[model samples]
Target: MHELAIAQSIVALAEQQAQNRHAAAIEEVELEIGVLAGVDVKALDFAMKSSVKGTLMENARIVRHDIAGEGRCGDCANVFPVNRLFENCPACGSYAVNILKGKELRMKSIVMATIGLQP
Candidate 1:
């Protein structure tokens, strides 16, 4: 699946970050994935497990933050929940709407080994 590639890219990014900091390994990783990001969580989890094999993040604890879909109506400035890309405004009944959230797929934070340094 495409999740494998996503997982591999995640691992590579984390590994590269750790290496740049001269870390011995990665301790934890935090990710933010929105509900409307179109990612299969189960598949991504499995792919991540496989992708981290023998890598710096092999022992890293992964933390995910799930964001709900939110949008704002352009016509009436009404804020509402949106599950689809194109949604009509609940208040004004207009199709003009801007998504405020729920389309994110990003790595939030990465905790790395101190490697003989005090923090």
Candidate 2:
């Protein structure tokens, strides 16, 4: 599924970041997934396990943050939250609405283990 590809890409990016910082291992991965992104959180978690098998993030914990979709009405200029995808604005009941947020699939942050030994 598409989620698998996204998971693979996330793992690749995390590995690259870990290498750049000379990290020994990846501890956690924080992701911000928008409601309109159409990503299955459970599927992503499973995909991460398979994708990071040979990478530095093999044991990393995938942390997902779900963001609600938001849009601004072009007619009334009102901003409101949306749970489903559609063209109509909830505030003004206008079809001319612009999406302000959501529909985003991105890795927000990463918690990495130090390269050197720790007590």
* Tens-digit lDDT string for candidate 1 (1-119): 88898899999999999999999999999999898888888899999999999999999999999888999998889999998778799898999888899999999999998678766
Position 21, candidate 1: lDDT: 91
TM-score (all chains, Cα) for each model: 0.91, 0.90
Which window of 10 residues has the lowest lDDT sum in candidate 2? 83-92
Model 2 lDDT, full chain set = 0.88
Off by over 4 Å in 1: 117-119
Give me the displacement of residue 30 in model 2, in angstroms.
Answer: 0.5
Clashing pairs in 2: none
User: Candidate 1: lDDT of 109?
Assistant: 100
> What digit string (tens of lDDT, one per residue) describes model 2 on residues 1-119?
99899988998899999999999999999999998888988898888889989889988888889988998888999888877778687666898878888898999999999767756
After TM-score superposition, what is the CA distance of residue 114 in candidate 1 from its true location, in Å? 2.7
Q: Quote the positional error of residue 16 for candidate 2 in Å.
A: 0.4
